[model samples]
Target chain A: MSEHILETQNLTKEFKGFVAVSNVNLSVKTGHIHALIGPNGAGKSTVFNLVTRFLTATTGKILFEGRDITTTKPADIARLGMVRSFQISAVFPHMSVRENVRVALQRATGSAYHFWKSATSLNELNARADDLLEQVGLLSHADALTVELPYGRKRALELATTLALDPRLMLLDEPTQGMGHEDVGRITDLIRKVSANRTILMVEHNLSVVSRLCDRITVLQRGAVLTEGNYEQVSADPQVRAAYLGGSHAA
Target chain B: MTKIQARNRLYLLLVAIVIGLLAPLVVYPVFLMKILCFALFACAFNLLLGFTGLLSFGHAAFFGGAAYVTGHALSVWGLPFELGILAGTLAATVMGAIVGKLAIRRQGIYFAMVTLALAQLIYFLCLQAPFTGGENGQQGIPRGFALGILDLSNNTTLYYVVLVIFSLGFGLVYRVINSPFGQVLKAVRENEPRAISLGYDTDRVKLTAFIVSSALAGLAGATKAVVFQLASLTDVHWHMSGEVVLMTLLGGVGTLIGPVVGAGVVVTLQNTLSSGPLNAYVPVVLGGIFVVCVLAFRRGIVGEIKALIKQSF
Candidate 1:
């Protein structure tokens, strides 16, 4: 309804006396692939956590689709259509790959609260679950135990499960972190493919992936925004260059 | 479940049924009923530990608490056995709701601590309560007629009754773990934060599981009261709580049938070693087996055997 899908106004979070995310205002436009880029300890994940209500903001207002959700419970916020992924692959490791996706789709079947009903009642979710898996190239591994999947494949499976939610806004924290080069590229491409129709806000370390996939970038330094622009504009900014060099040195 | 998996489970259940029918013939009926009662207790405990990932150390409160309630209802009020057990189950359910509400506010060791502390309180209450008969226990509890006709006085008749109750509890657990709700519980166990981000109300899920486990445990205890015609402080003791944990862990915490096997082994070992030259070493043998289970057979006997089979194929 608003120009921005998600807007955080003067958000700030502090632990004890230390500030993790300083006063920050971020607006993610609808249907845009927005990237929050920062070095380690720049509070990127903290922002994601705060936005998802995993952590309470010391001071701020978060608006999702123009609705004030700064005080909403985390689970309620998620059900309100804003879902997040963890820095690590979020999954049910003991279940099969398809079953992992089915967890998200199971809510649609209205039997998530029915313990007496057989799990086979979820058969209706299978076609969609497999379709999501195929989208992430995990269809062949549908029957494999989630824990047994290779690391890269596990990340792919995370994407499939997230997609199963069909969320209005997807907050992915470091979707390609701890991956090999091929995996990073494939994940970057997968993100691009899935970015249609929905809005996305991601925290990524790889600048090339950011440049290739993200429509807009917000560079953060010391828990504050350093600069914001399109890739070329950000790449040409001198302060952005110094921050990257400083960030790398700090890393 | 897949077709092959369902068939395998069916075969397993059939085998259990066959064993239940024949074990009383080869073994003492009273001893076999004891095994069945404990097996149901262990399985009910497993629903929380293995499936839901909640380790409730105060389960003795539910198991023993129901025994006292059933004992009072039957001996003092002359209620039917079915209603007496039902009353006991309802009491446990109410206790579970209250305990679960408070305990789920914490997690892991803290959760276990809350349950343990509460169960210990229940033990003291049982010790001091006049109606419970204190140290003497509620002895001479009449084994009344079942469903108004079948005489439960016969050991063989009672064995079948006990078997039926165990089957009902086991079947309910199996059905629950394979249901959609069970999937959420496992997801909570596997990754609680992720489940939250996925919009599942984990607290409610956990509370429901706690209540179910408690009610089934109470059912087992009420039946035990009828079998032994006694309810004692021992049922609510911290030792009883610890015993169920040992059974669950030894049988394999997460495996459905593992707890039953674990309960059988422990009950049989205690029975066999109670009177012989090894009478003084019952605790030693049980502790030794528990250590071995934690060390090499970490999945418990059934879990390890199942894993071995899976790996072989």
Candidate 2:
């Protein structure tokens, strides 16, 4: 097995006696695209939240880079090089597309606290932000406010902002939940390009994307791990097909 | 901003400075100073409410609290003019740090209530505090020498001093809202979770904004105390806080020129109505303006104008 960059031990979350996530263990390799998949209310999003420290685990531990970070604040996790993205596009709506990536890059440089200096002085970060936008195929929309971007492009911008952190491991919560087939292809390629150097853990509903992009898959049912395997092994499994794929046979 | 837009803004700034320089010659110097002080106060309030999405209801505590501190320092302690303003501003900064530390623990309306409660506490303390002179307040404060050179006893000299300070404070506010730190604070305002995920300690940013805003508000109040030569209980009253909010809302909460225009209009209305037969209806008229602004022009005066300009250009 390759080295595990992120691992969870009995990660459980409960809300008012409703166990959103229960006794689930997961591991993500250092240089692989791992996926978490489940049916609706399978606690897939909850698992993402738990690992990112957005929600405290009712009873469990999250380990990143071999350090137990179950209690680390959400901001601290990002600083530790484990950053996450929201399921919905979360760009700064009123700011320009270029500015969104610039702000993220500024945060990475520990200069987000420089109020005395003008923001125009941050032109030094423009080339890098431009490069990130180019990576996401948003170089043409740099000057446009994010509110004006099309849905697919907004998601691309969100990805660009995430990329600005140069994170060691990235947690993407439904990176392409709402997108056209063409946009999905674009984002899949983009993800493939970006994932060459870092680990990515994503929760996706599109099984095809999972099959093509993910090296390993973890299936969750009712807040617990049902199975773990490669796409072929997991898709061919009778239990996973009935519980998740609605008994539909995989190609 | 584009080159054309930047040049236009610079032109506007020059025009405003010229107008301010010549304003006292036409209008009463005391009245002009009153408007300038309140304008500065509103801008400071906007730093939190407009830019940071923090609505602090206890700003009167800083405005009036600093007035009292400066009034006492000048009248009772016999300090120089500049030193007294500095003392008062420092006191407000400390208050901002303490109150911000407590209030930032809660957000939205809860944050507003926390600030209001703290301001109320300060109001009571001022009422009972000997230095504040209770209900009568500290009166007849001398206009001490500025820099031990220029005598502020002259109204025109003091008016120019107040104008320069207001200009500096306004410029600083403009600089801050356009700074990188300010951009992060805007990010915090737009989406707290997104800002946190980007590795910004949002609470610390909010606290710093609160302190800077408080200090500037105190500067305005200190100048007012120096101008009027008195610090009254009315300054610290909750009504004063509400008035500043109204001024900001009417001017344009987020627009740079909004508060200044709002202050001028409100101050002019007060001066025009308070002495005339409409004295009893002054509050009613101001209330009417608030209703009209909220119902039809939610962006306030300057924001509406800015939108129009954007459309036209």
* TM-score of each model, paired residue for residue: 0.97, 0.97
How well is each residue in A1-251 modelled by candidate 1, as lDDT tens digits?
67899999999999998999998899999999999997788889999999999999999899999999999998888788898999989989999999899998886666776989988888788999999999999999999999999888999998888888899899999999999999998999999999999999999988888889889999888889988999998877788777775634422
Query: What's the lDDT for candidate 1?
Result: 0.91
Relative to the unseen true structure, what is the C-alpha lDDT of residue B237 in candidate 1, on a scale of 0 to 100? 88
Q: Which residues of candidate 1, in runs, are more than 4 Å off?
A: A247-251, B1-4
Residues B34-137, candidate 2, lDDT per residue (tens digit)? 99999999999999999999999999999999999999999888999999999889998999999999999999999999999999999999999988999899
Candidate 2's C-alpha lDDT? 0.92
lDDT of all predictions: 0.91, 0.92
Each model's TM-score for chain A is 0.96, 0.97
Residue B198 of model 1, lDDT score: 83
| Candidate 2: tens digits of C-alpha lDDT, residues A108-168 | 6777778788889888999999999999989999999989999999999999999999999
Let me know the TM-score candidate 2 reaches against the reference structure. 0.97
Minimum summed lDDT over a 10-residue window in model 1 chain B is located at B1-10
Error of 1 at A157 (Å): 1.0
